[model samples]
Target: MKKKYLIIGAGPTGLGAAHRLRELGADDLLVLERHGHAGGLSASFKDDKGFTWDIGGHVVFSHYEYFDALLDSLLGDERLEHQRESWVRSCSTWLPYPFQNNIRHLPPQARWECVEGLLPGNRPEAAPADFGQWIEGVFGTGIAKYFMNPYNFKVWATPLELMQFGWIGERVSVVDLRRVLRNIILERDDVSWGPNNTFKFPLHGGTGEIFRRLAARLDGFIEYGQEVAAIDASARTVTTKAGLTVEYETLLNTAPLDILASRWLADRDQTMVEAADRLTHNSVYVAGVGLDIQREAERNPRCWMYFPEQDSPFYRVTNFHNYSPNNVARPGRQLAFMCETSYSAHKPEKLDELMDQTIAGLVNTSLLDAARAADVLTRWETAVDYGYPVPCLERDGALKAIQPRLEALGIFSRGRFGGWKYEVGNMDHSVMQGVEWADRMISGTPETTYRWE
Candidate 1:
């Protein structure tokens, strides 16, 4: 006689939802994931050399105290806390991250060139109609020309002007003129200017370990690697890719609503299916490249590097090994690096070409020395996809209409692609969004993660 809940996707979001249900003393709740293992985009892998690598670039940073408490309880004192040492590789110089914060590294000639772009007339300040306008508005012509424009093109595979800026919260730093001038004059680093000045990682496993640990406490309550194919919401029954049908009293869907609506409600309700069609998604590729370098970043650990140059196929490169000693192969062996790129569905790319381009970028950016290319043991992984919500002008209007309709039907769709609000769509926001939704369901409280802020 207990109320039943059917949860989909065993990623962090789904795991959070399931954990909350157990805490609320709820029975008849089930969690299902399509991957053979959990973790979704945040999974990890080990190689023959006992080295670990994450699916994409993932870091643990939380804004809420409750989310922090949940992770502390789960991760315990063994968490590998990392001081975020991130930087931007602009042209031949390794500028301190948040490029605008530090410009002293550039030579006088380069400084003048950067200054040239900073003139008042060049500062784009017309309220930012798109992502391009947003970048120019925020950093001004100086940093945008040097980094934002070209780097964003490779990263998102779209014009910055065509994209929307609502999603760029802690992702990029907004410029400050007087502060930038002071930093360059003082010749100091301003890496801590962003929201995530410090982050945490698991001691043993990669980011994936957090979700795995959470699942362990939940008992054998998860159905792994099983995809949700269809749902008869009217009958309160759900069907899986393997043809298992289960009934539920209410449904918590964290999968892409388009997939949910198309496969489940397409035949049943034509409107739900059509509303989903308005959503847009961009594909993400994380390339794990193992290089044989004479001086491995191992000698000096740096958290990550950002690419704003066209030379690199990826817009971001996280020193996967630097996150933790466990992330790399045996130190005596060779070192490795990983890069990430987000692509549009309308613009697909071939892996071979991308790898070749990436290698070329390493040479141009001086990250990879061709002289030492012989010693480098290289491997490429395009294993994961799905990143960066493509925010066309119509995105906001479409989501506004679609979300309220679903909430009215006793369904809560939330997550990276679930609610599709990029402003607060990082790992911290995504997991907390799920937990808040679970709280709402348990106590009849309000949920902001689902509601557009």
Candidate 2:
């Protein structure tokens, strides 16, 4: 069978394209998803013990009005708004999120180190060459050594020196030195920071419900359980794993660009192949721990916490039950936590021992009391192979070489990994990438987010 537009992967990007195409009066379009269901990495699952968990820690926060309108239309009353109460676990004390901004929470020696390093004329005047240098230049040795260094290593699974700056944007908060000193001098907390300061979640299902409902709106358009095996770009044809060959005038690929370049493209040049090979990504281990009883009062209010120290195997832990009551089967009778531990070739993890390590980490961090360790009701674990796209020093070069080459062949690769842009890879951006791509194809509107310019 053939179609005018063939979108691969029913994730946000593909769904966005599908929705926009329908609105633009395009009929000969189809979406092919590898999984039996849609949502891609944003999907959720319910464990036997009646606890729901997302692929990792995902929340609904948007940077676009269209995305807000689409979500509101889909999950209206099912959405639950949350006041993001995030914290960082450091030196046996809970420091507010954006660890650099709240130096007062640290011990006497640590606080002094951070403050002294931040004193005038301490940092270098020149621009930082890499993420490590950027951290040292912006935050000084104390915040870099104490939190940014270790925490970033855990999260990125790549050496800081190998990564470039400029992708941070609003993801990482810049410190206000005067405010930090004032807070330390006044004995106050500077807790509010970052884009996720306030977000939303599904009241009944996990984060997946939004995407599932989105997929439902375009029910007959998606063909599930069919992975794209290969794409003959020159011939404008795609062959799925199920042996279905579909031809299209334009192809919007939402799968990883590396996979597209190195695996799927039948006539890939060595330059494009090697450029794709340079792309790096980390894997995540999501562990869902369901407790027999509700969390203690203090813990109940804490939405999520970060772990930078080596005492914990997981980098971040989300108080899932605190996000929404429907996360657990029994509501007030049960509590849930979703822990994310990242790993890669740079930082390896013993998957066999991950569960035990995560459990021990929970107890070590005081997230779970030692006495109630046995009260753990569910231990569900899932591994996502493509967690975060690393912005290595070579990322821009690779994207420059790869994206243009694919686009030249009428293949628009856009999405989280598909576009290989972490800065605009959020849910809103990913969907808008698709939306803009459809607009580009239908009405000749120039693509914004995915364009190199």
Candidate 3:
């Protein structure tokens, strides 16, 4: 097959690029997807018991107007608006989300420690060199020791010192000293701090509906169940696992960069192997537990919750049923929770026991009552090999060398793992990466958001 543009992976990025090409009146493009369906990591699943679960806790939020308009055009009135009601489980207490602003929920002694460390006398002189240092410098020793360090470890599956902090951007909420003090004094909860404060969700078909709809518009352009087995950069061709060959003038890859380097480009460039070896990421275990019961009144309307303690294996759990009633077979009669746990070489896991551990975690963290554990209807578990692109100390240097070489070969790798940029790895960012890559190819527009440097 010969095409003007060939895209690998039918995720948000590929779909976004295909959508843009259609909008530009360009029809000579082919989108090849490994899986039968679209959405990649953004895809949602319905378990045997009829409960919907996102790959993880994926809430619909954005930082781009294009993404916003796209959502409006695609979802229309099917999008359900939500006011985020998230919380943190610590010391058997449910502190409001943004734990830094709600220290009043902590014990008096713990509260005092957090407040005293924020005092002027305890201020540090120099800037932070690593993530751990940044945490301590910004949140002080108490918050770092109590919450930030352990919670981050559970999420990132890497030591803080081994990771860089620049990728945090808007993902993390910086502590506001005055707001913290005032909230503590006035007994107020400051839960409104992140871009996801007000968000939206699909009213049906889970989050995957958004991408599936986008893919639907492309009609016969998408070739599903055709995995790219190899790529010959010199010939500008892609070979599928089915032995089909497709030729392209420009290639947009949304596949993981490490896989692309080692599998696709290894014979072409030996340097890609070394560059891929240095790129680090963690694997994730997403456990979706469906219960045969109504929503518990105590946790009603709760969107998601975080667990920082050792009693649970999961770092975060989303009340998936709260996001959309259609997620369950019978809206008010069933409930669902999706638990997320990450593991890497730095933090190995006993994969065989992860499902059991996740269930125990739900019980341990009070999301599921121990007495009602027997009422669990279905348990679905899936693993993603590339959960998060680790912001290791050497990541930027690796990307700096690897990206330009691929781009020189007429390949634009721009997506979550393709760009290997977690700061801009949300749904909006991933789609925009594809859209921008198309713009750059068509009109020589510079990719401002996902820069190679």
Give the best candidate by lDDT: 2
Task: Compute the lDDT of residue 419 as modeled in candidate 1.
Answer: 72
In terms of lDDT, the poorest run of 10 residues in model 1 is: 291-300
What ordering of candidates by lDDT runs from best to worst? 2, 3, 1
Q: Residue 304 of candidate 1: its Cα lDDT?
A: 84
- Which stretches in model 3 have alpha-carbon errors above 4 Å? 294-299
Clashing pairs in 1: 34-225, 131-163, 132-160, 132-161, 292-376
> If ranked by TM-score, best first, what sequence of candidates would result?
2, 3, 1
Cand. 3 Cα-lDDT: 0.88
User: What is the clash count for each candidate, in the order shown?
Assistant: 5, 0, 0
Q: Roughly what TM-score does model 2 have, to 2 decimal places?
A: 0.98
| Tens-digit per-residue lDDT, 1-453, candidate 2 | 889999999998999999999989998999999999989888999999889999888888998898899999998887899888889999999988879888799999998889877888987779889999999999988898789999999999999999998899888998778989899889887777878889999997798888899999898889998998999988999999999899999999999989999999997899999999899999999999988774455255888899999999999999998888889989877878899999999999998899989999999998888888787889999988999999999899998998888889988899998998899888889889999999989899998787654
- Model 2 residue pairs with clashes: none
What RMSD does model 1 have?
2.5
Please report the candidate that would top TM-score against the real structure: 2
Among residues 3 or more apart in sequence or in different chains, the pairs in candidate 3 whose N, CA or C atoms overlap within 3 Å are: none
Model 3 TM-score is: 0.97
How high is the CA lDDT of each candidate model?
A: 0.73, 0.90, 0.88
Please report how far candidate 3 places residue 440 from its true position, in Å: 1.3
The reply for model 1, stretches above 4 Å from the true place, is 1-3, 107-110, 267-275, 291-298, 331-334, 345-347, 378-380
